[model samples]
Target: MKRPTLSKKIDQLIYRNHKSATTNVIGCLVLHAIRSEIFERFQRAYVGMANKESSELGNLPTSPMAERARTCETTGERLRNRELAYGFDLDYKNDPPTLVPCTWSKNYAIGLYGRIGLQCYNLQNGTNLKFKRLEKHSTKRTGRYSSVYITLDATDPATGSVCSFQTQFSNAGSHLRLRARITWLTFAARIKQIPNEPIDDDWDEDTPGINEFYKVPLPKWFSDERGSKKYYVPESELHDNDWLQLLMEVAFFSKANRRLDAYLPLELNSVVVETLEDEPRDKLKADNAIFYISYKCCADPCSTPLAGDHRAVVRKTMDGKPGHMCLEVAFTKEQNKNEEE
Candidate 1:
């Protein structure tokens, strides 16, 4: 056998003299991912990779590796136990998109979509499940369609008992159309060991609603979610960072779509807004929601501002999800100069 030198092109790798050359490959890769285009290609290759990350709590795969992991400790868990080691949740490349719960509770827009999914499922299955509240949700984004997986508890009228559910949907173009859809949905099973209407336990808490629903809802509109609620908000709320950005974007694209020419919104004018709520006509209730913003945006950044009222149809919700939601300019309505002034 040839002598194995510590490193290539070197006589020896003196372990003591040089602290072992740490490859630090992961760190390097992370840096490269941020700096290089190759990382984007890598991300594209694994765009839907989380579809295979099914080792979530209740949805754990029956694979041998997963089976063994269930009985004992996982390598990650072992690493976590060691004080010397540390873990970064969803910080690394290829990690499952982080799940959002602590935040979704306050996000009214997300709650709107969750209701739409439940409403659609009810329409198709001939079941009336009243929405209680959102528990959590996650999402995977792509250029054209961003996939959403949502979890929440609901009230089953037939049983008059509370039940929990998970649903998956996409925000493509199914805005306020009953032709809207959810990819899959599931509810908590009544296991004897689980007591009291089978509410959320550790197993239920960790269970994901990505690819499994008890039954398909709205086979026709099953690819997306659509529906929206409308109410007046204090003008101050419109200036919130996320809301302002979204409204501006909606303003920019709305003008561009009709004109087919490049245009941008320079300023947002505060005004009491009239909101529109559209209901889908076909299979299920609308889950893709649209928001009506009666606000003005400057067409020419350097010129005098013109007043305009626009409605934004925001379809998607962020991932974790509060990450990304779709928004659209429904229509640009003209405001009388007298009123605008």
Candidate 2:
């Protein structure tokens, strides 16, 4: 039998929601197109592997081929789940909110595509999660006002953990808030504890508590409730410095209907206000244009910076206009040369 096409499935879903008239048909179509592209790429890889034969002998390697096929099948199932999570259906009311698997190659795509799917769902069906709009600001007088808000709650299904959500409105317009929200079910779930080590200090009796000789601390998991000595384990040896793994859910909200436009007066000439040594001067000069800017916390926000850290530059020319300035931003790590030296 022939397999059903993604477009066909989308059409069926759209038809089912015909009565409600609340569905964003175009949004669904866009999701379908993305899924189709991903599926085709996965299928091509699978087929290529299946057709390959073993090199040394005359026979093909059945085990590796079978494993590849299984991996492809798993990938296909994940894609299907993603479609269902984003697809419009009447039965979604009874289903739980799920995360779509993100491919390593297309990790960045998750933010945009996931937001589109989420916003569409929010518009069609009101979620139980709640949030408060904090403030709205506008840089350009003629442009739309950007609203900022905080997510009250978030829940993660994999670990049954909950966390407070916070995000800024880069897409907020005058009337619409495009921010994402946590589902009510996820918000209600209880948080789970992560395994961690406890710290201990052994000091000399004669020394002051503030300035006493001390010993290294033990891991929390190895320490008893009394906090004196490390709890001994019979079967396995534990270390004091092991890292703990905790799972938390977080959500992003993008507001819509507002476009912030930046226009630089052409007559004004560009000048280098200040230049630092060892900086990418050429790239910096390319991005000195006036434009709407959005900021988000850098990945690994808690990580310490090192020397010779690098960041990629992202630049966009304003509406492709000539003599228009481009805005560029780069993520770089701050280094403490004094400490290293």
Candidate number achieving the greatest TM-score relative to the actual structure: 1
**RMSD after CA superposition, every candidate:** 20.0, 28.6
- Evaluated against the true structure, the overall lDDT of model 1 is 0.40
C-alpha lDDT score of every prediction, in listed order: 0.40, 0.27
* RMSD in angstroms between candidate 2 and the native structure over all alpha carbons: 28.6
- Candidate 1 residue runs with Cα over 4 Å from true position: 1-104, 173-341
lDDT of 1 at 108: 47
Over 85-176, each residue of candidate 2 has an lDDT whose tens digit, in order, gives: 12111122234633322222222222222222222222223332222211111111113422211122344445665553322223212111
Best by lDDT: 1
Q: What is the lDDT of residue 151 in candidate 2?
A: 22
Give residue 258's lDDT in candidate 2 (0 to 100): 12
Residues 1-341, candidate 1, lDDT per residue (tens digit)? 88664233132323222345455556545544444565566655453333333335456545554454444445665454342101111211245433243343644445545654565455445576777877666665544555455666788868889876554445554222222212122222211121122222111212242222211122221123432233444556556533344445544444443332333454445422222224343211222333333455655545523434543333321111211222333322332232236
